[model samples]
Target: MRIRTRGYERRRRELELLIVADIVTIFAWVLGFYGLHPNGHIDFLNPWLTIVVLVPLGAHVANRHLAADADAILLPLATLLNGLGYVMIGVLDPTQAHLQALWTLISVFAYVVCIFFVRNPDSLDRYRYLLAILGIGLLFSPMLPGIGENIGGERLWVHLGSLSFQPVEVSKLLLAIFLTSLLVEKRDLLARLRGGGLRRFGPIALTFGLALAIMAVEKDVGFALLIFVTFVLVMWIGTGNRIYLLFGAVTFVLGLVVGGAVLPQVHQRISVWLDPWKHAATTGYQLIQAQYAFGIGGLSGTGLGLSHPTVPVATSDFIFAAFGQELGLLGTSAIIISFLLLIGAGLRVALRAHGEFSSLLAMTMTIILALQTFFILAGVIRVLPLTGMTLPFLAYGGSSLLTNYILLAILMRISHRSNQFNDLREGTTG
Candidate 1:
C-alpha cells in the first residue's frame, strides 16, 4: 500500500523525540572517542554521517510505516546502529578501511524508515510485491554495476565506489515475505501435512530441491541452507506439521551431502569447521580468533577498547568477536539474550496479530531474525562451518543494519497494533 498519514502523527512526533535522545547518546560517544584521540582529528563528524542521520528520516517521511504503531524498542534499535557505526568509523579509521558502513547507513536507513514512516504500520499488510521485485532483481544482481564476485565464490555484493551493498539483503527480505505469503495462504492445507498420507507429502520438498539445484550451480551452500531452513520453519509454524519437520531434516542431510560432493567450496567450509586450527593460516583464522576471544573473555569482558580484535573485519562479519574480545563472554551473552528476547517478542506479536497476513509477516520476520542470529553465532562458535554473513545490528554493514532495522520497526508496529486490538476488545483504548 502507498504511504499515507493516519493517526500516526503523534507517533511520529514521539519518534522525533527519541531521535533527539539518540543524538544525545551519539554526542557523548563521539566526545569520548575524541578525547581518546585528542592529538588526532576525530573525523566521525562528517557530511557522510549526516546523510546517514537525515536521509532515512526523509525517506521514512515518504514511505510512512513509522507512525502506525510506534514502540519503545524501535528507538533503542536506531540508537544501536548509530552507536555501532560511530565505533566502526572511529576504530577503522586508523586501520584505513573505507567508511562503507557510514554511506550505507545513510541511504538504506532513509529508504527503510520512509517505507515504515509514511504508511501506517497497521497498513503494511505485507511486502509481497516488493519482495517479488527483489527476487527477480537478485537473480541478476551480480550483473549490476560494480558487482564482481567476492572471494567466498558468490557474486552477492554490488559495489559503488568505496561502498558495497549486498543486493541479496533485499532478496532476503523479499524471499521471507514471499514464503510467509504462501504459508499464510495455505496454512490449513499444509497444516494437515503431518503424518496424514502420500497426499500430504511435503510440496516444499520439490521447491527446496530446486533451490538446492540453483545454489549448487552457484556453489553457495550457505544461502541454500538459510532459504531451506526458512521454508521448513515457516511451514512448521503455520501448520504444526511434525512430518514436514522430519522431511526437512532428511532433505537437509541429503542436500548437505550433495552440496559437499558437488561443491569443492562447501567441502572446504566443512573441512575448516571440522579442524579450523589445521587451516588457521588460511580460511580458519576468523573462527580461531573468535574462539580465542570467547575463551579469554571467560565471563566479564576485558572491557571495551581493551581487547585485541585480531580477527579480520572484526566490525562486520565477526562483530561478535569484537564483542567477545572487548566486552567478554558476559557481554556477548547479553547480546545473545537480547536476540532471544527479540525472537520471543516477535513470536508473541505474530500470535496476537488480528490477521493471517500480519501473522505471517511477524512469523516470517521472526524466523529471519532467529536464523540470522543463528547463522553468524553458529559460525563464530563453530557449530556450523564459517559463512560470510554478518552479525545483525552490531555488524558494520549498511544493508544488513538497514534491513534489520526495518524488520524491528515492522515487528514493533505489529505488536503495538495487536495490543491495541486486544485493548479495544477489552474496552481499554476507548
Candidate 2:
C-alpha cells in the first residue's frame, strides 16, 4: 500500500509538471504573437488561438487519464518546441500560423489514435512487409500524373483536389516501423561477416537503394541523404556491425559524387555550398540572406519582428536562421537543448524497453529524429550542403508536424509499457 501510494504521488507530480509546461508554452506563444504585432491586441475570443492553446493541455489530461504511465517529459518537451515553432511562424507569416494551428489539432487527433491503438510495439512486426510496401507506395505516389506537384525544385508533394502534402513525411514513419521490425528479426543474419554472400543482405540493400534512387530522381537530395544516414544508423545499431556502417558511408559518398556530376540541381547546390558568395545573385541568394540574419543577430536576438530579414522559405527550410535572427544565439541554443533532451528521453525509453523489438523500435525512431534534426541544422549553418529538410518541430510544414506528433506518441507508448514492465518485475521480486 505504501509503495502504491508513492507511485501515485510521483505520477501526480509528473502530471503537474506536464501541465505547467503546457501552460507556459501557451503563454509563450500568446506573448510572442502579440510582441510581433504590437498593434494587434490579444484576442482571447479568437477561436483558433484558443484551440491552439488548449489542445496540448487537453491532450496531456487525456493521456494521463488514458495512459497514466506515459513519459511525462516527452509530451511537454514536444509541446514547448511546437509552441516555439508556432510563435516563429506567427512572426514570419501569420497566414501559416493559422494553417499550422489547424494541423496541430489534426496532429493531436493522430496522437490520441496512436496512444489508443499502439499498445504493444512488438505486434507491429507481423505486418512489417505490408507496412514497407505501403511506405514505398506513398513515397512513389508523388510521381503520379496530375496529382503530383513540384515546389522549390523538389518533386515531393502530392495534391489531391484541394489538399496537398509531402508523402515522404508519412513514408518516413512507416519505413522506420518496417526497418525496425525487419532488423530485429534478421539481426544475426545481417551482422554475420561470412557465408550467405549477396543473397543474405541483397533484399534489404535493394529496398533502401531503390528508395534513395527514387528520392534522388525526385530531386529531394535532403530526404535521400536523411534516409541513407538513418538506414546506416539503424543497421549499425541493430546489428552491432561496423562493416555495414563503413560500407554504407563509402557508398553514400560515391552516390553523392556521381549524383552531383549527373544532376544539374545537385551540382548547383554543391557549387553554392562550396562558395555561396560566388553565386549570391543566383543559387546562393538564400544562403547569403541567412548568413546576414545570423550576423545581425549576435548573442541576443533582435527581439521578435524587429529585424525583418528577407530569406526565402524562412518559415520552413531556413527557419533556424529566422529564429536566430529574432531569438538570437542563446534562444537558438535553448531550442537545440530542448531537442537534445527529447532525444535523451527517447534513448532512456530504448534502454529500459523489455523486448528486443520494442528496444530497437524506440532506438530507431530516436535516431531518425536526431539525424533529421542534425541534417537540417548542419545544412542551415553551412556545416553541410543544404538539402532542404524541415527542422523537426520548429519548421513550418503540416505533414512534418503531423508525422513528428505520431512519432512522439509511439515513443510515449513505448515508455509507458517499459515502465509497466519494470514495475511488474519489481513487484514480483519484492
Candidate 3:
C-alpha cells in the first residue's frame, strides 16, 4: 500500500512539473509568435499550437497508468527543451515549422508506443550481433550507389523514393544498444587484457574503425568524432580500465592530424576554425555572421526573431547561434543549465538501474546526448570546428527528433523497471 501510494505521489509530482513546463512552453510560443508578428493575433486553430498544449500532458497521463514510478523529472525536462526548440524553429524559419510539428507528432506517438511495448530493455542483449549488423548496414546505407545524396558536399543522406533521411541517426541508437550489450558480456575479458591489449582491442577497433571509415567517406566528421568519443567512454566504464581511455586520446589526436593533412573537407574546417577571417567572404562567411550575431546579442537579447540571424543553416546546425543572437547570453545560459540538469537526471537513472545492461544502455544514451550538445555548442562558439549536426530537440530535423524521443521513452522504461523492482524488494522485506 505504501509503495503504491509513493508511486502515485511520484506521478503527481511529474504532472506538476510537466504543467509548469507547458506554461513556460506556451509563453515561449506566444512570445516568439509576437516577436515575428507584432500586430497579428495568434491563430488558436493551429494544430501546432494544439500539439504544444496537449502532447506532454497526454504523455504524462499515459505514464501515470503505464510507468508510474519512472523518474519524475525526465519528461518535463524534455518537454521544456522540445517546446523551446519548436518555438525557436518557428521563429527562425516559419516555413519549416509545419514540417517540424508533424515530426513532433510522429515522434511523440513513437515514444508512447515504446512505453507500451518495450517491457524488457535488457532482453535486447540476446540479439546484440544482429543489432550490430543492422547498425553497420544503416551507417552504410547512404553510400549506396543510386540512393546516396550529396547535399552541400556531405554524402550523409539517403533518398528512398520521395523520402530522405539520415540513416546514421538511427544507426547511432542501434550501435549504442549493441555496444552496451557487448560491453556487459565482455567487460571482464576486456579488463583482464593487459599485455594483449592490441589483440583484444582489435575486434572492437575493427568494428568502430569501419564506422569511422564510413563517416569519413560520407564527410561526417562530427558524427565520426561523436561516436568515437562515446565508444571510448562507455568502454572505459564497462571495463574499469584507463588504458582504453589513454588509447582513445592518443588515437583521436593522431586521427585529427592525419585527417587534417589528407582530407580536404577536414582540412578546410580546421583551417576556417583557426582563422575564419582568412576566408570571411567565402568559406568562413557563416561562422563570421554567427559571431556577429552573438556580438549583437550582448546581455539579454535583441528580442526573439528581431536579430534576423544571417548565418546559414540558422534553423539547424547553427540554431544555438540564432538563440544566442535573439536571447543573448542569459538565454543561452538557461539552455546550458537545462541540458546539464537533463544529463544529471540521466546519470542518476543509470546509477539506479536494475542491471548492468540497463545501466550501460542509460549511460550510452546520456553520453550521446551530452557529447552531441557539447560538440555543437563548442563548434558554434569557435571552441571547435563546426560539425554540421542538428541540435537535438531544437533542430528542425525529423530524424534527430524522432530518434531522441524514442531514446527518451527507453530511458523512462528503464527508470520505471528499476523503481518497480526496488518497490518489490522493499515490500517483500517489510
Candidate 4:
C-alpha cells in the first residue's frame, strides 16, 4: 500500500509539472511573438492562430490524463521547442506560420493516436520486415516520375497535387522501428554466433548499407549519414561489440573521401566548408551569410526584427542562423538547453525501459533525434559540410514536426510501460 501510494504521488507530481511546463511554453510563444512585432498587433482571439498555441497544450493535458505514467519532462520540453520553432517561423515569414500551425495540429493528432494505439511497444516486432519495406519504399518514392520533386538540388520531396512533403522524414521513424525490432531479436545471435562478428551481422549491415546507399544516390547525404550513425550506435549497443563502431567510423570516412572525389555536389560542399569566402558568390553563399548572422549576433542579438539578415531558407535549413541573429548567443544557448533536456529525458526513458525491445526502441529514437540535431547544428556552424538537414522539432516542415512528435509519443509509451513494470516490481518486493 505504501509503495503504491508513493507511485501515485510521483505520477501526480509529474502530471503537475507537465501542466506547468506547457503553460510556460504557451507564455513563451506569446512573448516571443509580441517581442518580434512590438508595434504590430495580433488578434489574440483569432481561431487559426489561437489553435497554434492551444493545440500543444491540449495535447499535453490529454497525454497526462491518458498516459499519466509517461515521461514527465519529454512532452513539455518538446512543446517548448515546437513553440519556439513556430515563433521563429512566424517572425521569419508570416505567410508560412499558418501552414506550420496546421502541421502542428496534424502532429498533435499523430501523437495522440500513437499513445492510444501503440500500447505494446513489443508488438512492433511482428511487423519489422513490413516496416522496413515501407521505409525503404518511402525513401525512394521521391525518385518516382510523377510525384517526385527536387528542391535546391536535393531530390528529397514528393508532391501529391497540392500537398508536398519529404518522404524520408516518415521513413526515419519506420526505419528506427524496423532496426529496433531487428536488433532485439538478433542481439544474442549476434553475440554468440559461430562466425566472427562481421560475418554474423553482415546481412543486417548490408541491408542498412543498401538503404544508406539509396539515400546517398538520392543526394540526401544528411539523412544517409543520420541513418548510418544511428544504425552503428544501435548495433554497438545491441551486440556489445566495439568492432562494429570502429568499422563503421572508418567506412564512413572512406565513403566521404570517395564520395567527395566522385560527387560534384559533395566536392563543392567540402570545398565550401574548407573556406566559405573563396566560393562566396556561388556554392558558399549561404554559409558565408550564416557566418555573418552569427558574427552580428555576438552576445544578446540585434533584437528581433530590427536587423533581418538575408539568409537563404531562413525559415528552414538556416533557421538556427536566423535565431542567432535575432535571439543571439544567449537565446540560442537556451534553445540548445531545451534540446538537451529533451534528449536527456529520452535517455532516461530508454534506461528505465523494462524489456529489451522497448529499451532499444527508446534508445534508437533518441539517437535519431540527437544525430539529426547534431548534423544540422554542426553544418550551420561550418564544423562539418552543410548537409541541408532541418533542425529537429525547431525547423519549419510538416513532415519533420509530425515524424518527431510520433517519436516522442513512442518514447512516452515505452516510459509509461517501464514505470508500470517498476511499480509492479516494487509492490511485489514490498
Candidate 5:
C-alpha cells in the first residue's frame, strides 16, 4: 500500500510540473511574438502554437494508463527543454518553427507507440545481433552512391527524391541497444583479460577499428568520437574494469594521430579550433561568430527575439549560441542544470533496474546523451573542435528529435518495469 501511495504521489507531482512547464512555455511564446513583431497581436489559440501544450498533456494522460510508475522527472524535464527549443527556434527563424512543431507531434506519436508496444524490455536482447547489423548498415548508409548526400562538406545525410534525413540519428539508438546486450552477455569473458588474452582483446580491437573507419571514411569526427567514447565507457561499466579506461585513452590518442595525419577534414578542424581568427572569413567563420555571441550574451541575454544571432546554422548546430546571445548566461545555466538533472535521473533508473540487461541498456543510453551534450557544448566554446552534431532535443532536426523521443520511451518502460517488480516484492512480503 505504501508503494502504491508513493506511485500516486509521483503521478501527481508529474502533472503539476507539466502544468508549470506549459504555462512558462506559453509565456515564452508570447514574448517571442512580441519581439518578432513589436506591435503585432499575440495569438495563443493557434493550433500550431498550442501543440507543445497538447502533446505533453496527451502524453501525461497516456502515461497514467500505460506507465504510471515510470520516472516522474524525465517527461517534465524533457518537455521543458523541448519547449525552450521551440521558442528559441521560433525566435531565431519563425519559418522553421512550424516544421519543428510538426516533428514534435510526430515524435510524440512514435514515443507513444514504443511505450504501448514495448511492454518487455528484455525482449530486445533476443534480437541483438540482427539489430547490430541493421544499425551498422544505417550508420554507413550515407556513404551509398546516388542516394547519399554531401551537404556542407559532410557525408552524413541521405536524399530520397524530395525527402532527406541523417541515418546516424537512428543508427545511434540501435547501436546502443546492441552494445548493451553484447556487453551483458560477454561481461564475464571481457572481465577476464588474463586467460582470455587475444580472444577477449579481439572485440576491443574490432570496436576501435569501427571508430577509426567512421573517422577515416565518414569523415565525421564528432560522431566517431561519440561512438568510441560510449563504447569504452559502457565496456568499463559492464566489466567493472579500470583497465578498459587505460586502453580507451591509448586508442583515442592513436586514432587522433592517425586521423590527423591521413584525414584533411580532421587536420582542418584542428587548425580551425586552434585559431579561428586566422580563418575568420572562411573556415573558422562559424566558431568566431559563436564566440562573439557569447561575448554579446554576457551574464543575462539580449532578451530572446531582440538579439539576432548572425552565426550560421544558429537554428541547429549552434543553437546554444542563439540561446546565449538572446537568453544570456542565466538561461544557458538553467539548460546545463536541466541536463545534469537528466543524467542523475537516468543513472537512478539504471541503478534500480530489475535486470542486468535493462540496467546496462539504461546506462548506455545515459552515457550517449551525456557525451553528446558535452561534445557539442565543449565544441561551441572552443574547448574542443566544433563538430556538426545537433544539440539533442534542443536542436531543430526531425530525425534527431524522433530518435531521442524513442530513447525516452524506452527509459520510461524500464522505469515502469522496475517499479512493477518493486510493487510485486512488497506484496509478497506483506
Candidate 6:
C-alpha cells in the first residue's frame, strides 16, 4: 500500500511538472509570437485562439499526469515542437500572430479529443482503421462538387464555409500510421522483403507507384518524397533490413525521373533551385525574397521589427524569411537547436517504450515531424525546390496547428508512462 501510494504521488508530481512546462511554453510562445507580429494586425482573437487550443491540452495533460495510457505523450511532444515553430513565426509577424493564435484554438481542441479517443493504446489500431476510412474519404474530397481548388496549384484542399482543410495531410498521417501498424503485424514478412530478391521488386514497385500516383495527382512531389523517404527509413528501423533501404533509394531515383518528366512543377522546382534569380518575379518569387532576407540578415540581422523580409504572407509560407530578417542566423540557429531537443526527447521515448506499437508509433511520429521540418527548411534554403508545407507548429494554418497539438499530447502521455515504469522499478512511488 505504501509503495502504491508513493507511486501515485510520484506520478502526480511528474504530471504537475508536465503541466507547468506546458503553461510556461504556452506563455513564452504567446509573448514571443505577439512581439514578432507585424504592426496593426493585433486583435482580441489571438488570446481567444490561444485559450481554445490550450484548454484541451490542459485536460489531456491532466490525464497524462494521472498515468492514463489513453492520454499518451505523442501529441504533447508534437504540439511542443509546433508551438516552438509557431512562436518562431509569431514573434516575427505581429500582424498575423493573432490569426495564428485563433487557429490554434480549434487545432488544440481537435488534438485533445483525438488523444482521449485513442486512450487505449491497445485500441490504437482500431483508431488507425477509422482514420484510414476518413483519410481515404478526404483524399477524394476535393473531387466533390463546389470545393474551391487551386491552393498553391494543388487540388488537395476542400473549402467549407470560411474553412479549408488539406485532405492530403490527413491522408498522409493515416497512411503512415496504417502502414506502420500493418508492418508491425506483418513484421516478419516486411523483414523478409529486404533480401533484394526479384520477389521483392513487385511490392516495392506497387508502393512506389501508388505513392507516385498520389503525389502526381496532388502535384506535390515534395510530399511524395517525404512519405517515400520516411517509409524506407522507418522500415529499416522496424525490421533491420538493408534491402528496403537500397530498394527505396533506387525507387526514389526512378520516381524523381518519372515525376520530373510528367510534372512541370517538379521540373520548375529543380530549375528554381539551380538559379532562383532567373525567375525572381514569378514562380520563384518566394524563394528569391527568402534569399534576400537571409542575405540582408547576414551575421546579425536587421533586429526585431526591422527586417525588409517580412513578405506579404510572412505568417504562412514565407515565415522563415521573416525570422531571417528579424532574428538573423543566430536566432534561427537557436530555433533549430530547440527542434533538435524535441527530436532527441522523442527518440528517447521511442527507445524506452514498453511495447512494439508504442516504439514504432513514437519513432514514426519523430520521423514525420523531422521530415516535415526538413521539407520546409529545405524549401526555404533552396536545398530543394519549393513546397508549401507550413513550418509545423509555426505556420499559420488551423489543421497543421491542430495536428501538432495532437502529436505533442501523445508524446507527453508516453513520457508519463515511461516515468511510471521507472518509478515502479525504483520502488520510490508514492
Leading candidate by lDDT: 5
Q: What would the per-residue lDDT of candidate 4 be over residues 1-430, giving only the tens digit for each residue?
A: 3444433554566556656755654565566567777876766675655766678767766665667667677876787777777777877787787788899999999999988899798898899999999998999999999999988888999999999999999998898899788777777776663665456657446745764575466877788778888888888888887867787878787777877887777888889999999998988999999999999998998866667768999999999999899879998999899898889999999999998989989999999989899889999999998888889888899999999999999998898889878867877421
Name the runs in model 6 displaced over 4 angstroms.
Answer: 1-61, 64-96, 126-130, 193-203, 425-430
| TM-score of each model, paired residue for residue | 0.81, 0.94, 0.95, 0.93, 0.96, 0.83
Better of 1 and 2 by TM-score: 2
Candidate 3 lands at a TM-score of 0.95
The digit string of per-residue lDDT tens for model 3 on 97-190 reads 8788888888888889989988888988888889899998998888899999988888889998988889989899998898888778877778
Stretches of candidate 4 off by over 4 Å are 1-38, 192-194, 428-430
Give the higher-TM-score candidate: 2 or 6. Answer: 2
lDDT, candidate 3, residue 269? Answer: 91
lDDT of 2 by residue, 54-123 (tens): 7877677667766667677787788778877887788788899889889999998898888888878788
Model 3 RMSD in angstroms = 1.9
- Residue clash pairs of candidate 5: 301-328
lDDT (Cα, 0-100) at 358 in candidate 4: 91
| Top model number, TM-score | 5
**Comparing 4 and 5 by lDDT, which wins?**
5
User: For model 5, how many clashes?
Assistant: 1
Off by over 4 Å in 3: 1-4, 193-197, 428-430
Give the per-residue lDDT digits (tens) of candidate 1, residues 1-430: 6443333553565457548745753564465455455566656566545554554455344324444443444444444444544554455343322354454555455546544562444344366667666675774576655564565677666776766667666677677777677677667767773444554454576557756754765555656677778878778877886877898888888877887898787889899999998999988887898888787777886654445467777767777876676667776776777677667767878888877777878888888878877988898888988767777766666677667766766776666666667756776422
- Model 6: lDDT to the true structure: 0.67
